[model samples]
Target chain A: GIQVEQSPPDLILQEGANSTLRCNFSDSVNNLQWFHQNPWGQLINLFYIPSGTKQNGRLSATTVATERYSLLYISSSQTTDSGVYFCAVGEGNSGGSNYKLTFGKGTLLTVNP
Target chain B: DTAVSQTPKYLVTQMGNDKSIKCEQNLGHDTMYWYKQDSKKFLKIMFSYNNKELIINETVPNRFSPKSPDKAHLNLHINSLELGDSAVYFCASSRLRGEAFFGQGTRLTVV
Candidate 1:
């Protein structure tokens, strides 16, 4: 089994603040994804960065597969961004039955207007 | 249109009862998954099906059963529900080696 840990379990920011969320895995994985679980419990995909960096709107993510870690960046945060962000990864070399992504506890972010 | 959808946005039932949740995907994806979110918001994979074939089944209990009719629908049925079964369940779908899209989630309350 792979161990996934997320840093800064909680965060608070202003409307124009910037923050970075991190996820570290105990094993190597080829499938890594970032999702934002909105207040309504809607888990929306933010990135699929198994490696490298990607940006969408004010959000961006970077994953270093070899280092077994990934980062999610939120720039100019907004009130709507107040929720929990989750990082999930699937171990690539764990033999069979390792196709599912193991999720971290998550990072709760609160943005005030 | 929604990529993934689940039925019974909320479920409240007594212990020892049985319930079923329905899921469907309209993204033309071949793989679908079921994830359980506990009270503390920890997400864990329950079951996964690819192209109508069962694939990933975590260490979940046997009381939970997943049924996939073709490639577009995957349903979850729980027998003799217990208090530990109370959680928010999410249905997701994706293509092989692609990003997954999750549904709105079904909140189950086993009283």
Candidate 2:
């Protein structure tokens, strides 16, 4: 089983601030995903970057597969962005059909208006 | 339309009761999963089903059973639910090594 660790267990910032959350894994992974669990408990997919970089609106993520690390950047955060950010990784021989995703404890982000 | 949806967004039952949570995916994905989020917000995979076949079954207790009738649906049944079973359960679906979509989550409170 692969272990995923998220940094900065807690974070607080003003609405206009910027922040970076990181995730590190202990082993190689075939799938790496970033998710935002909003205050309403809806798990929204942020990015599915197994490698390279991807940006979505005010949020962006980069995954360095070889280094087994990923970073999610939020620019000019809004109050709606306040919630738990999770990083999950999947490691197994069956591509993704039968593999299970192991999730990190998550980074709790609070963006105050 | 919701890509992944589950019934009974909130469930409350007494101990020794049996309850079931139903999940369905419209994404036509072959892989579906059941994940549990504890009070501390720690998420963990409990079961995984691919093409209606059981694949990954974590160290979950025998009281928790997952059934997939078709590739698009997966349901979880808990027998004699215990106090420790109180948590938010999530249903998700994804393609092969693709981005997974999660349901709104079913918060279960076992007394």
Candidate 3:
């Protein structure tokens, strides 16, 4: 089993602000993803960065696999972005029986208008 | 159209009741998964099916079973549900990729 830890378990930000969330894993990962769980309970895939950086709209993600850490950044945040953000890491072994992903506890983000 | 969709947006039942949640995907994916988000908002993998075959079975309780009648569908059945079974259930689909498309969750409440 792999251990994933997210920082700043709870975050509060004013609308239009920018923020960065970090996820650190205990081991190397073959897959890394950032997800946003909206108020309606839909898990929206934010990024699929096992390594390198990716950007989409107001968000971006960077995964430094060699350092066992990843980051998600939200710019020009909106109130609708308030919810739980999750970072998950799949066990590095793609050929093993444990291809399951281990998720971090999540960072609860609150956007204030 | 939803890439991944689930039926019964909300479920409420008695402690001893039995229920099921249905999921479907149109992304032509070969793998599907069921995940449970407990009260603490912790998402854990319950079961996974690949091409209608059981591929990953976590340490889920025996009362929970997953059935995949075809590549596009995977349903979860719970028997004699307990109060602790109350949570949000999410359905996700993916192939040999890192990202997964998730359906709107089904909130289950046991009284």
Candidate 4:
């Protein structure tokens, strides 16, 4: 089993601010994703960066597979961005079917207006 | 639209009852999974199915069973539900080694 740890378990920011969240894993991963759990309980896929960097709108993610760490950045946050952000990782195996993903405890973000 | 969808966004039941949550994905993925978010909002994997076969079964209770009739569908059934069974259950699907897509989640309440 892979161990994923997220930092700053609770974060609060005023609207229009910027923040960064970090996730550290104990082993090399074949798949890594960042998800935003909105207030309505929908797990929205933010990024699927097993390695390298990716950006979408106000969010961006970078994964350093060799270092076993990943970072998610949110810029110009809005009230709608308030929710829990999760980072999940799946280990690499010879079978080529890593069906299970290990999720971090999540970083609860609260963006106020 | 091509997405992963689950039935019954919410469920309320009494102890000793039996309930089931169904999930389907049209992303042409071969793997489906069930995850439970407890009261503290800690999400954990309960079961994983690859191409209609069980592969990853965590230390979930025996009262909980997962069935995958096809590569696109995976359902979870819980028997003799207890107060501790109340939580948000999520169904997700992914390719053999790709990122996963999750459902809206079912919030179950046990009385």
Model 1 stretches with alpha carbons more than 4 Å out: A92-98
lDDT (tens digit, per residue) of candidate 4 on A1-113: 88999998999999999999999999888889999999998999999999999999999999999999999999999999999999999875769554578899999999999
The regions of model 3 sitting more than 4 angstroms off are none
Q: DockQ of each model against the real complex? A: 0.68, 0.79, 0.63, 0.76
- Superior candidate under TM-score, 3 versus 4: 4
**Native-to-model Cα distance after best TM-score fit, residue B54 in candidate 3, in Å:** 1.3
lDDT against the true structure, each candidate: 0.91, 0.94, 0.90, 0.92
| A1-113: candidate 2 lDDT, tens digit per residue | 79899998999999999999999999999889999999999999999999999999999999999999999999999999999999999877855546878899999999999
Worst 10 residues of 2 chain A by lDDT: A91-100
TM-score of every model versus the real structure: 0.95, 0.98, 0.96, 0.97
List residue ranges in candidate 4 displaced over 4 A: none
| Model 1 lDDT per residue over B1-111, tens place | 878999999999999999999999999998899999999999998998888989888878999999998899999999999999999999998886568889999999988
- Considering only chain A, what is the TM-score of each predicted structure? 0.93, 0.96, 0.96, 0.96
Please estimate how well model 3 matches the true structure, expressed as its whole-model Cα lDDT: 0.90
RMSD of each: 1.6, 1.0, 1.3, 1.1
lDDT per residue as tens, model 3, B1-111: 889999899999999999999999999988888999999999999988877888788889999999999999999999999999999999988874447788999999999
Q: Which candidate is the best by TM-score?
A: 2
Error of 1 at B95 (Å): 1.4
The reply for model 2, stretches above 4 Å from the true place, is A94-97
TM-score of chain A of 2: 0.96
Best by DockQ: 2
